[model samples]
Target: MEGDVWMKGYFRKRGARWSFTLDIGRDEKTGKRKQKTVSGFSTKKEAQAAAADLIAKFEQGQYVEPSKVTVNEFLGDYMSVHYRSSVRPGTLERAEHMLKNHITPAFGHAMMKNLKPLHFQRFYAEKSEAGLSPGTIKGMHTFLVTAMEMAVTWELLPNNPARRAKPPKQQQHTISVWSHEESEMFLQHAKGVSSYYLIFLVALYTGMRKGEILGLRWDDIDFEAKTIYVNQSLTYSLKELRISEPKTKSSKRAILTPVHVLQELKKHRLRQKEIKLKLGTGYDNALAEKYVFTTSKGNFIYPQVLNKALVKLCKELELSPIRFHDLRHTHATMLLSLGVNPKIVSERLGHTSIVITLDTYSHVLPAMQEEMVTNLETAISKIQTVL
Candidate 1:
């Protein structure tokens, strides 16, 4: 009875109780003739106020369908808008796989309004129990949290529930590296193997990553200067080698090789020249680009293929088994054991900063404490004599 736009309200005959409701009608700014409505207001003043509020909200672009969005939908939109173009193709593919295989299937259809922190906590527990490593589960949580942050920006949700979710605590673990004896034995075995042996040597000496090594070209090598340029990384897609710029600007620079490594490289270059001459017309066109290393067929050596070769070598040598990547750790460990400054090691490794180098190699350099004490003692002796 309040107004035509108002719907019927509740009233008690004996107690004089009153209830109010609002009737909302949408207004189209243009001539599309579209309209929307919601009803039930008891008082005329209340109805008018509700109408004004709705108009202002709609004008301010505050109206949103709370039920229209699902977790999957939002994640998809966010990936398309924010992440699709920003990451590498491999990275994008991995993200998609993670979302589809682990994240989206579980919560993809869940309504944005109903998601809660406990749901994610349960998810973390389940994933951990299922044998997923803490590091990988942590990555999943990170992706979820980032996606929820986008939700907040979009005003689809009031807050990020994922922020409150407690992920499993990560455990610190160290991987084993080659001892000096083992390292020497491995190098001895690699002698006369091929220029391919030089790959592992460079990895152990320079701490360069496998991708960076595979990406190296003759132009990047300065034999006279005893330096190697690291401006790119090689990746594979659709069964083809693709050379992409390094992941970071810090990764793009020159690193000096040891005198011994330079000598080995000189030998390698000569061997490569002979192979090129022997192949004649059968040599690959790709090999003409001056890549420093390649397969016998003159194709870029894939990282996986190199890893398999390392595994085979490790097995034959009866060495304490480790991943191909552990060679980099071996290099850092040897350097730090010799009391090398962490700053110098970090620069050679092309780490973005010294902190990363220290964090990674600190465990391998436990002798640093003794070295520091010795230096301090020497300094104190000098000071006492001066006094």
Candidate 2:
């Protein structure tokens, strides 16, 4: 009853207990008021002390509303208001899965206003220790920060909890391509066993992606011109084979086939004509989907089916197994070894720019350093002779 309250009768039932009651009515001039009544005490001194401490705490701004906001609520608001419209469908699906499976479980029940940097730090450390790969954890961290950033923009949080949270270090993995000898062996094997040896030759010579190889049609090739146009790619979507425009504008450029490869193309064309005549009128236009690579039934070749064949063939030839994609890598590697300019290789490979080509094939270009040294040595020798 410091201001306008009452102290009820004391009790000694428990070891030590104290409580106070309050009227808490506002002073008219001040218009400030509060009311709480708690009455249980073993001694008057203890009750007074306890009441004083309670009043002190209430005076300070140390208390917070438990139900202010939760991480779950914030996540919902973040996704619905910001992410759904901005990201692509595939990217959104990955984000949604990451949040639901990884993020929400770790921080869902936490009060948004009370979330701290230490909580995020501990969570990231524990995830790393649990054997989650750094790249995967980094992806989750990116999603969380992205969502919380939106929360800040919407005024739901004062600052991002993920600030200063360091992402895990990623391990560098080297990409491997076939050696010259291995490529030659594989080409010979393809020539002897696969009816589509020209397909393999074209891939080795042109550095086209597997999808691009499968998507090549008769109209895209000009026999007299010795040029192959790459304007579309084959992909499986909706459980059916479909042809779609190249993934990027840069991927639609034309490539000039080497004269040696042109000779092979002429032979392959004659073989195709023989096969078409043998099939007669039964060779329907639908059957002529004009695929450069296909099965005996003339059906569009699936990537998985081709990959299986490549693996089986490698095992039979006693060669170390390399992914079908490595065929393209082999092509790029050979061209760089031959001292072809990266700009020309980049255009042929349909990369967006030379920088991308150089970055991807940097390991293969270390010989260029020795070439530079040779040039420098020759210049120095010429200057010394003149002197």
Candidate 3:
């Protein structure tokens, strides 16, 4: 059975189920009729009530068409169109990987408009039960909040369900850094055997990020002034390696280098030149931006390759294996222990704020506190003798 225009929308009974259709007016450009149909009500009264609310929204200019776009497809569009320009390649890559492996498998097939806060709440609970870290869950929550906000703005959904959902509490892990003796042992052991010696030295001495070190060009290093310019980062994006700007405004800084580190840098440059001469025109290093570090084939080195190399070298030297990033932490920890000003350390590490540097390194700075106490007591004793 079917009925015409019950409460400004058509109604029909198909077998035991009731359905409704609303006229959404005509398309201006095409002068064509437009309509929307929603079905699966248990009673004719229920279909009638649902259509009335939809009509009210349509009149108020607050109505959005229920789209067939699945969460997976919409998110794909969102990342490519919205996130491509806003985020770096490495960030985009990780986000996409997380979406593919963790998120999409849960509710990607569901209709985008039908997503509810409960769906996401269950997702977090399930992920937590599966032993995922709270910080990681928090990251996923952040991504959903942003993506769904964009959906609301684009009128793909009327509101952001993710904004109402709660994720697990955030958790942080202790940062690890090398001791001075271990740093010396590694450097001494690596100097003789490792091809990545200069790279490791640059990380420990400059406190630069792995991406920053990999992205360095020879011209960025000023041998005379003993300075290193951090301009860009080497990152992977869309299946290709590329260089992008630094992580933040402060990350692009010029670090003053020690004479010894610069001396080793000069030796590294000479070696690069000799390799270029041997490769002749076959060298990709002949490019305008001459990279400070590269593979024997003259191609830029991948970041993961460097991580693997560091791990293998640590095992060979019989030292506790640490991430390549931990070397930068080692540099900051060592300097703080030597009575270097916190502000100076912050600037050298290219932290956006000095507070970040202080908070991050405070756990490893007990020696610095002891040294400060001793100096303060000595100064008070000297003043007392004068009095």
Better of 1 and 3 by TM-score: 1
Tens digit per residue, CA lDDT, model 1, 208-243: 888899888889999888899998898875456788
- Cα displacement (angstroms), candidate 3, residue 264, comes to 0.9
For all candidates, the clash counts are 6, 0, 0
* lDDT by residue (tens digit), candidate 3, 265-301: 8898788888788888887767523888888768888
Better of 1 and 3 by lDDT: 3
Clashing pairs in 1: 21-40, 21-41, 22-40, 22-41, 23-39, 24-38
Per-residue lDDT value at 132 in model 1: 91
RMSD to true structure for each model, in Å: 5.5, 9.7, 5.2
Candidate 1 least-lDDT 10 residues? 9-18
List the pairs of residues colliding in candidate 2. Answer: none
Error of 2 at 130 (Å): 4.7
Error of 1 at 112 (Å): 2.2
Single out the weakest 10-residue window by summed lDDT for candidate 3: 280-289
Model 3: which residue pairs collide?
none
Report the Cα lDDT for candidate 1: 0.78
